[model samples]
Target: MGVTIAIDCMGGDHGPAVTVPAALSFLRSHADANVILVGREEAIQPLLGTAQSEFGARLKLRPASEVVTMDDPPAIAMRTKKDSSMRVVMDLVKAGEANAAVSAGNTGALMAISRFVLKTLPGVDRPAIATVLPSMRGHTYVLDLGANVDCSAEHLLQFGVMGSSLVAAIEHKERPSVGLLNIGEEAIKGNDVVKEAADLLRASGLNFYGNVEGDDIYEGTVDVVVCDGFVGNVALKTSEGLAQMLGAMLKEEFSRSLLTKLMAAVALPVLKRFKQRVDHRLYNGAPLLGLRGVVLKSHGSADVLAFSTALARAAEAASNRLIERISERMASMNEVKA
Candidate 1:
C-alpha cells in the first residue's frame, strides 16, 4: 500500500517556502506516496500554485491556523497551540488519515505534541530520536539524538530495541548488532548508569556488541549506537562543527597560493565526490522512534534537498510497517524481562 505523509508546512526556518517545494519534489520522486500539507490556507495556497492540478488527490492541504515556531516551548505547543501545524500533523497520524508525519519545527515542541497525541508504543517508556549517520559500513543508526537528556539504564535498553527494530525494517537486517556509546570499550568504563545499561544490553535479547567509543560510531563498529540524549546531541553537533571546519580549512588552503590553486583544480573531481559521499543532506530524516505512529523530524535549518530527503524516509518507514516491527520487538523484549 502507498504511504500518505502529513507535513507541517508552516513549521520550520523557511516555513512553506521550502517545505511545499520539497513536498512536491518528494511526490514526483515517490510515485506511490501522497502528501498532506498542513498549514494556513492563505499562506500555502500561493506556493502550491498548480500542485493541486499536478498531484490531484495525492497532494492535499489540511489547513491549520497556528504555527509552532522554533522558539516555542513544549508546554506552549501542547497547551496553547491546539490548531498548530505541528499538532495537526500529529492528529492526522493518530486518526490514521496519514500513515506518517514529518516536521522541521521546534524539536522539543514536536516531541511533546507527538507523544501527547499518539502516546508511546506499549513497553516504551520514552520516545527517542534515531538518526542515521554516515559511516564506514555505509551508515549507523544513533539514538536518542536530543530527546531524554537524563535517561535511565532501562531507557538505554529500550533505545537499543527500537534502534534494532528500525534497522531491521529499513535494511531488513534480521539481527542488527547494537552498541552502547560510552567513554571506553571496556566493561569497567563509564558511570553507574551506563555500566548498568551495558549489563542489561548483554542480557537483553538484542544482538548486543558491547561498549563502543565515540570513534567507533564512524568506524561502523555496530549497526546501532545507543546513548542518552545529552551525549548524543553533543556528539552530533560536534561532528557537524568539525565537518564544517574541515571544509572551510580545505577551501582556505586551496585558495592561499597559485601552486595550491592549481593542485585544487586537479583534485576538484575527487573533492566533489568526497563531498557527495559525506553530504549530511542525503541523510536528513530522523524518526522519533517508540511512538505509536510514525513521525520523522527534518533538520530545522534544512534546505529543499534536506526536507525532501526527510519526506522520502517518512514514506519508506510508513509503508514498511516500522511501527509494527517496533511493537513486535518491544513485546518480545518485554516477554524476556518477564
Candidate 2:
C-alpha cells in the first residue's frame, strides 16, 4: 500500500544529517511512498537540497522551530516543545496528513507525545513498544519494550492481542502464537500477575504458547512475546550489551597474534554471516502499537541504514493497516467478553 510518512528530522543524535538522507534512501527503495521532512528548515532544507526535485511532489519539507533533546523529560517536551520536530511529526499523523510518523528522538518524550496526540484505539488501555529481534526463526516481535512499566494481568492480555494483531497485519500471519515472558514454562511458575495473565491469555482464544523464559526470546519460541516494560526493557538492553561485548571480545582475540589473525582471516566469512544475522540495524524500528496511528521509534544512535529500516517499518505497518487489525481484534475480544 502507498503511504506518506512524516519524519522528525531534528530528533536523533545525528539530526537532519542522518534523517534526511535516510528518508531519501527509503523513498528510492519504495516507489509508492511520500515523505515529509519536519525540522528547522535552515538545517533540513540545506540537507534536503535539490535532491527533493528528483522525487518532486513525493518529497517535501515542513518546518518546525524547535528540537527535542535526549535529556528532556517527557512532561517538559509535551508541555513546552510544542513546535519541536518530534511533536510536529506526531501532529501530522494525528491530522491524517500522514499515514504514519517516525522519529529517532527521546524515547520517553516520543511515547508521551505520540500517546497524547494520537490517543489509544478503542479498548486499548495502553500502548506498547513492539520491537523486532533477530531470532532462530528469522525474527520475532516483542512488546511493552518500554511503554508501560507496570502492567496488570489484563494489560498483559491486551499486549498479546495487540502484538498478535501486529504480526498478522505486518507479516500476513494468521493465528500467530503469543507467549508471556515468565520465570518458567509451567503455568504456575510465575507471580500472581503473570499466572493470572497466562490464564487470561489461555482463555482469550489467542494462540497462547504458555510461559516462556528469558532465553526463549532469542530462541524464537513464539511469534510474539508479551511482558511489562520493565522486564522487556531489561531484556532488550541486556541483549544489546551482550552483542557489543561479544564484538569487542572477538576483535581482541582476532588481533591477539599472527596465528589468531590468520585464523580470523579463515573464519571471516562465517563471522560476517553471524554479524549479519544479529545486526540490530536490520530490525531498527519499534512500533508504538495501540496508538490511533502508526508511530515508529528508531534507535537514537541509528546510522543511515538503521534509520532507513525504521522508515520502511513505518510504511509497511501503515500499508498493512496495523491499527485497523488491532481494533478488529479488540472488538472481537470485547465481543467474547460480552
Candidate 3:
C-alpha cells in the first residue's frame, strides 16, 4: 500500500475552504498516496463533492468533532479536546494508519499532541520544529522554531544532527553541512548553553561548520542552522516580517510614478520570480523532529498552495525515513553514550 497522510481538516484560519481543497489537490497529484481527512463529516463531505468517485477509495474522511483553538493552552487542549482534529489525526499516525500528519492550527497544541501521541524516537531528547525559509541560494533550514524554548547543550547537538539529516532528505544533498546559530561567527560568542553546545558540536565529530551569524541564514552558507527555540523563533519571525515589509515597500514604490509603473511592468516578471523566491509561504510547513512519524506544522494563514506543498513534503519525509535515520545517527553519537 502507498503512504497514507492524515490531515487535520478543521485546522488553519481559513478552515475547510483551504484545508479541504489542499487535501483534494494532494489526492489529485499523488495517486499512490491516500488522504485520511479528519474533521466534522458534514463540513468535509461537501468539499469532497461527487467527483470523489474519480479518486476511488484513495480519499477517505475520518470525522473529528472539535478543533483546538489558537489561543487555547496546549496542555488544556491536549487534555480536554480529545476529539479535536489535531489530536485525532496525530492518533492516526501513532496507530500506523498514516505515515504523517499535517496541521495549520495552534503550534503548541500540535507539538503537544504530537509528542503525547507519537512520542519521541529512540535517542531523541526532544523534538525540534524546523521550518524551511526561502533563500537566494535555493532554501535554508532553521530549527527549534518554538517547538522548544529552552534547550540543553545535548539537545542542541541532537538538533544539529536531526536538522542536517532533514536537509539532506529535502534538498537531495548527501551529508549537508550544518551550522550553529550565534550572534557572531566566533566560537566564543553567546551564553553558556550556546558556548557549551558549540563545543559539543565541534567535538562530536559531526559535519559541523562552526558558528554562523543570523545574516548567514538567508545567505545559505550551510544546509542547516541550529539554535534554541528562543533564538530560532525570533530569527524566523524577523525574516518573515522583513520579507512582508519589503514586499509592501516595493509595491508602493512601483505605484509612485507613471515611469516606475511602466518600468515595473517590464521588470514585473523577473520581480515576480524574485518575490516568489523569498515568500515564506512558498516553504510554509516544517517537520517536528523526534516524533515517531512525521508531523508538519503549516502556518495558520497558509493557502491551498502552501498546504499542497506541505503534503508533498510529508511524502518526501515518509519515503526517506527521516525519523529512523535520525534515530540511527543519534544512537551512534559518541558524546551521547559517553
Candidate 4:
C-alpha cells in the first residue's frame, strides 16, 4: 500500500549484482517502500538469496526477456527492446502499478523511452536531467545534465522554471534563485541563444540571478543552474574527474612516508567526514524532470551504495509529487505569457 518503485535490475554496469542488493538495502531502510525488480528472473533470483524471505512481499520480480546494453543506440533500443528491463520498469510507472521508475542504464535510451512512454508535462517541450551537487553553501540543483544536446532559448527558459520547481520541492525553498550558466557573469556574455534565454528568464517571474560562471556551481551562488545538455554534461563530467583525481592525489600524498602516514592516522576521522561530504555516491540519482511520471536515472557505473541512493532519490521525488509541481509551474508560466 506504500510507494512502489519499479527498478530496471539488469540495466547498469554490474546489473543485478549491484541493483538487487541496493533495492534490498533501500527496502530495509524504508519500511513502507516496495520494489518491483524488472530483469531476467534466473539472474536476479540468485542475488535476492536470503533477503527474499526476510523482505517477503515488499519485494517482487517482474521478468524482462531482454536488456538494453550500454553500447546500444537509443533509437534501436527503443524500437527493439520493448520487453527490456528498462522499458518494463517504465511501463510499470505508466500503468500506475508503480509510483516511480529507477534505472542505472544508458542515459540516452532512458530519456528517449521515458519521454515516449510517459510523455511530457503540459507546456513542457522537453525533459531535462536535474541532479543535486555539493556546494559551498549547501547544495545546488543543476539541470539539462545531458538530455537535450541542442536546446532553444524557450527550452532554456523552461529549464529554469522546472529547475526552480525541483529545488523548491526537494529543498523546501520558496522562490529558489535560478542562474543561467554562461562563460562570464556579464549579461553581454554567451551566444545569441543564451542572451535570449536570459532575457526571457528575467521576465519569466523566476528568481532570476542573471549569469553564473562554472565556479558559481561549487560556490552555491544560486539554487539552480540551467544550461544546454552539451555544456552541462561537460561540466558534470569534469567535476567528477576532478573529484577523483583530488581524492587519489590526497591518498598518495598521505601514504608517501611514515611521517605522512602517521599524519593521515591523526586526520583519519576528519578525512572520512570530508570524503562523506563530497562523495558522488551520496548524490547518485538524477531526476528526468518535466516527465508526466517519475523517472530517475542513476550513473551507469554506480555501485550498490550509489544505486541505493538513486532509489532513495526516486522515492523522495515520488513522495513530493515533483511532476505535479513542475506542471503547475509551467501552467503559471503559460498564463503569464498569455
Per-residue lDDT tens digits for candidate 1, residues 206-286, read 999999999999999999999999999999999999999999999999999999999999999999999999999999989
The deviation in Å at residue 70 for candidate 3 is 1.1
Q: Cα RMSD (Å) per model?
A: 1.3, 1.5, 1.7, 1.4
Could you tell me every candidate's TM-score relative to the true structure? 0.97, 0.97, 0.95, 0.97
lDDT of 1: 0.94
lDDT value, residue 174 of candidate 4: 82
User: What is the C-alpha local distance difference test score of candidate 4?
Assistant: 0.93
Assess candidate 4 and give its TM-score to the true structure.
Answer: 0.97
Clashes of each: 0, 0, 0, 0
RMSD (CA, Å), candidate 3 to true, equals: 1.7
> In candidate 2, how many Å is residue 159 off?
0.4
lDDT of 3 by residue, 163-264 (tens): 988977777787888899988636656889888999989977678998899988888888889999989999988877887888899999999999999999
Tell me the tens digit of each residue's lDDT in model 4 across 1-338. 67899999998889999999999999999999999999999999988878878988899899999999999999999999999999999899999999999999999999989988999999999999998999999999998988889999999999999999888878888899999999964565799999899999999999999999999999999999999999999999999899889999999999999999999999999999999988899999999999989999999899999999999989888988788889999999899888
Query: Model 1 — which ten-residue stretch has the worst lDDT?
Result: 182-191
Residue-level lDDT for 95 in candidate 1: 97
- Rank the models by lDDT, top first: 1, 4, 2, 3
Error of 3 at 192 (Å): 1.8
Candidate 3 pairs with clashing backbones: none
TM-score computed on alpha carbons, candidate 3: 0.95
> Worst ten-residue run, lDDT, model 3?
182-191
